[model samples]
Target: MNTKFSKLSFTIAVSTAMIASASLASPTVVSFSDATATSTSGSFVADNAIDKNKNTHWEADTDGASITARFGSCQRVDDLVLNWYGTNKYTYSVQLSKNNGATWTTVVSKTSGKGNKNAQNVTDQAANAIKVVGDTDSRLRIDELKVNSLGSTNGCTSSGTSNTSNGENSGTSNPSTGEVSGGNAQYPADVLDLSKWKLTLPISLNSPPNSNKATEIKQPQLKTYTNSEYFRLNAAKNGVLLKAIAGGARTSTNTAYPRSELREMQGDGTESAAWSCTNTDHGMYLEQTLLHTTTKKPEATIGQIHDSKNDLVMVKYVGPSFANGSTDIGKLEARFNNDNITKLLDSTYKIGDPMTIDTAVTSGGNVTVNYKNLRSGVRSSTGTVKMTGIIGSCYFKAGMYIQACSKTDIYNNTNTVCANKNLSANKYETDPYAYAEIEVRKITLR
Candidate 1:
């Protein structure tokens, strides 16, 4: 054979062999609902390995780096294959988590892993998330991660949507509706460091006929406060659950919507946080999942930076077919100045998928936002917004700030009175159970 043709034939043969091996390892390949890593090096990101492309690889920046893969719902995972970068030996371990990465149980451990491929039999284990940890001192590199499920379900719920059931449907009784026994009751502060933050509830501190001003809890009080109905820990006591109802109280007489959110505070939370956009750079990050939304208007603002007068940018989720004759399935959007908007993630976004939101504002008043749909490995960014001469002082807010309310929501609570009568009316249920929920696992500010 000609030399060039011979080399091409040999390459094809190797590629074919690798594909066959992958097929055998995963008789029924299970797609990852979401993938995330602690860190990555260069262009080799975590999603690259999960993309099932041998040509692209993920390299850890340091040793002991780990990547997590979550199924949309529960799965009976039995096999996991790691496509290593080269023939170098590696030490690694695989673990399983049933409580959404809160706790883990190790199932596979290898001290001397060789060749370009390594396979481990994890047995038939029930898990919603799987983690592979690099045990070696050197960087862990992988081209792909192949997983096999042994059952008939692919993890999606019956409604053809991703299952993001709350405590009631998650095999655990909801604290809001029932008493939670065992494990000391955890507060939002316990799960997240909230020393520099304060909470704003959807309800008022006083009764009706009095001021309907939304209640604000600061330091000392926030450290120990946990509301079963609005802000508290999840059933597992591993994440903070923020819930808001359309009939909930508003922030002020001028405000239209209700929110169960957190506001950045100054120093020990004794004073309101206020900073000029030209003073210093600011950033905020959150690892959260939207659990539920209102029926007709399934929309909520997850994160945002607001000025003393108006909001600068908002990381929001708009539900499917939200407006009349609209074809939108759902989307993660970055709304700038409540005017210009950019879609970060499209219809693939689901109710119970892991989402990462990172946004920053420069000293020059330029704003930018990036979103990662961990479940679908989709990532997008809003390049930058030039607002040097347009905006002023601003602060950060994160949680479930629902962008929905109806006259029925107001009429539902005959005791309280709302100033905004132009509010949209509920079109779905006679007594709209307009509710929204978010599970915040992690948050950071800088």
Candidate 2:
């Protein structure tokens, strides 16, 4: 007789208990250990933003200024609250970094703000550092900054701390990414030394004159630059990703395929890196995985030893060939004589499988290649190419060089659609999404 009343009572009691539990779950307030600003006004300092006093404020010296705060350790931040000092609108972005300030991940971006206070939810985000970069005709001002963190965390540890005041850690430039020093260099620039390489992008400006040329980055700028589409750190922040699409820009008119690759560079990244394969041991060691290849061709060159005109040796992937009943799919082949290849590396390799490859020319000019599959235990080598003559002025190249291209690719259609003689505004995209990607974990050259 009282069933309905009994159910309503139980529901009320459950709701009350849930509300009580929610009220008991409180967030912890995080404090900053140090703060720095790109520019600061006379009386307003970067520390004022985190001082917990709404009366004191931090003001930027100019537009496009940025302020950074370092936590004692990494933290799982739940939310952030910024109290503005004035009614002036500001366009800004919030970025988080786990490795000091070397790399960053944008968490919140505001193109324009009209309110006096802004709160952003960043739950479960891990970061040891935070930065606020703003652009406005009027200087940006922050009265207070607050962060709500999760429970206690040990956070990420740096490999080594910097002793110099310049903020960069002490170490030799990374061979891969060329990062001078950080906690660790485990991802893209994981080998060789980045100071000795340059990056080539499969993109260019569309406007007249130089539109036909691919973009290249070298030296100091290459050390910290990353392009989201062509080259960037993987999600795990432990590998470098190189991508190329079917209709992207080519390095030159004669090149049909586009590539997001690295070329050997010399001192300070200003000169091309070239050396003779005589009296010196030249080699490159790579740890990488092929992530994708165009559906039509399913082929890409991941590593190469190149001369001025031709690739002497290349680690190429051959997708399953339908003509052969698809038996040739996932084969890792070593290419020589520009076209000749040997499937001695791995006949049954699968995409996303990690592999280690070692290609070298001995001091005596004898070439050698070795391969090992980290997961399947498959291994093979080419021993040496039939060295007819010594190769000189050669350099090492790594990253993705997609072997597929569309008929509209720069090389094929330079007349009609591409006739303006002006560079395409961006990378050509004949087959949108038909692309190749490689995760370069490590690359070492000697």
Candidate 3:
């Protein structure tokens, strides 16, 4: 329901910067046959993805498999164009391998695949190979795989865009590979550099008895939050992982809104930091991969973007949609603007079944959400409203906010212990609380 900088000025500045950074030389488009192919499963396999044949497809046996394209030499690959066959959702990462695949770095993690633009910009990287790996609900039927430079004198090639020639594909594409434009590798933050942010635990509005206004249940400012035994916030190969100790605190309040979030410094809309929280004409963009361990009732949340105070807007992952009002919650749904709740994406999420979320909120009230469920190769998008509160002083937060409340406190405001039994402990108890855990791979801001 709610949501940059001075629109006109910032827009002009950004445009000028873009003009200044333009490359004079044309970029080389790596051919499909340029790299070798390999995968975790399937035969028409890795190579087929780039074989320039709509009739050929690569299928994985399991849900989360991989298809890698290894080049002969290190190439500065900044963007890619992939045409997928069969209309299914996919959650996958476009990764670059510099050290021969023993380890890899992610260029971008995509969660919404259906109707995804063929050209995807990733971190500007020099790697010998690039691969797509993740979870899929249906068999993989990916075609038209081509790699391109972030900025090329020549645009993406028409030959790179795929059609439904193989049969099951359905969608509308102008099919122009002409210099598939891309963004620069401008990731500013990592796990080690989250010092500017402050951790606010279990803040919520009072229910029946505690008064009806939105207020803090227990707004303790823990100084060394990221250093918790039950929680971990660390830099991963390409992104960051915000995790709750496997047996960490899940709930910390009787209020339906139990939270653990990070708030940015006041009026410090700096873009040079690890991640940009600036409200500019260019706006601030954040992309991250989310993974969870629990599917319990009273669905928990994963990622969010908030203002200085008040939960303006956020993403809530309901293990089983609460609207059904039944625990038949095997199917998980990604709900946006949980302050009012709008279904953005839905599927069954497992520990390894990663979902990639791409969000861009403009200085204006415009917000865009793109979701992908890896192997399915299908992506979905939503254009929603981002209120104006945070526009002046906004920050991005990614972590678990369990919404479970103890039965004793469901109707009465008496039960002090949160559902997860994290807080409200005796003065003698020193152990930490069990939390809803999440691993955030990468966060990039522009």
Candidate 4:
């Protein structure tokens, strides 16, 4: 304890203090040379070596033998860094295996030549055991090998200082953490809109008007449902839930009847007198449900009637028929292709009318249907029907239904007798006409 102690005593005191401070200040950097070389029965040789800069480190030499450093039983190192000098490019690939090297997966492969000393980061989305494999150029030397954990660690905190592991800095946080955080997190623009959230619309909205003029005049304009608005509006307020009714007629009579009477009798018995006196009116009705099975929304419907002896007629009838039987109707007709109709029906028509032709094989073919007569009318029986041009191959389905209702009175006074007696005296003949047609086709992409 004397003020001037011996040199040995002074040196020992200083050394003791230095050791204690070093232990508390930093983690002990255990050089690979100090640690025992872990040996396995495999071809890998684990050893400690000094680098060209005299840095002590661990090394795995696959020099003549393949070497791998295994971690614990289940998790293997995912990344490694090697320091070496070499000539004649050396190619090596990193392999990984979860099953103790039973099956190795190649993660990274690189070639190094003279003046090559760098850290390589090996990342494998799927890897368990990480090691290096040498290619044709076998003169390989690895000065240092460090393993790194692959995925993100949830509840672990790394020492604040940068530590090189798997050739990447592994620490609690990096200087550019803010940039990384901002780049990874993003939200969609429409997520905040509540108006777009619910699929159903409010009931206060109005339903749209029907496209059929005959149906429109007899039906209230407000009462008629429009396909456009019906989806959002409540079904009860839309209109009457009536079945779809449609038909066509061919008459030699050259007179254009007034529109008012024609709209009143559409699909009903009000025009029995006119229907019986003329021998030329003919048509059919094709109807389906309005709402789709998946959407439950009002949708446009299509109807087609094929007459083998006449022309194949396809009609797209909009709702809300006219009071005067005068409304714009979309019609298409063409000569039928027996083969094409068969295939279209086979694919879409499951429950409806069967196809007259086999639709399975003839996917590409031409068909035609002629529109000999077309007309818009208000009363059920009397309206100006025009003859439209023929439509060909416009429809995917070919087979449809056609029914003929003919009113015949041998005595020309049938109309007068019915008016006076108020009795059903007109001779009515109904017959089912058979024609080849395809089923309805869905225009949705598969």
Task: List TM-scores for all candidates, in order.
Answer: 0.60, 0.54, 0.44, 0.21
Supply the global lDDT for candidate 4.
Answer: 0.23
Give the root-mean-square deviation of each candidate in angstroms. Answer: 10.1, 21.2, 17.8, 31.7
**Model 1 vs truth, CA RMSD:** 10.1
lDDT tens digits, residues 187-261, model 4?
110111111111111111223321111222122222222223211122312111222211112111321110111
lDDT of 1 by residue, 1-446 (tens): 01111000000000111233355233355666655565444334455666677776656555566776665566655656655545656676777766555446688777887646566666555666667766555566666666654443333222211111111122232211112221343567765667778898877677552234778899989978999889988876657899877766777666667899999888877687888865566767677888887766778899988887777788888886554212334778888766565546455677888787767676568776767777666777677775533456788999999876654454345323332454345533223246788998666565
Which candidate would rank higher by TM-score, 2 or 4? 2
lDDT of each candidate versus the true structure? 0.63, 0.63, 0.40, 0.23
- The residue-by-residue lDDT of candidate 3 on 312-405, one tens digit each, is 5566656543332222333344344436656556455444455555555555545655555553433455555555444345556655565444
Give the winner by TM-score: 2 or 3: 2
RMSD (CA, Å), candidate 3 to true, equals 17.8
For TM-score, the strongest prediction is 1
Give lDDT tens digits, candidate 2, residues 121-238: 6645566777777777766666666655544455555433211112333444433222334335443443225677799887765454242477888878776678888888777555
CA deviation > 4 Å runs, candidate 3: 1-97, 100-145, 148-196, 200-228, 233-257, 266-298, 308-310, 321-341, 384-393, 407-434
C-alpha displacement of 382 in model 2, angstroms?
1.5
* Comparing 1 and 2 on TM-score, the stronger one: 1
TM-score, ranked from best to worst: 1, 2, 3, 4
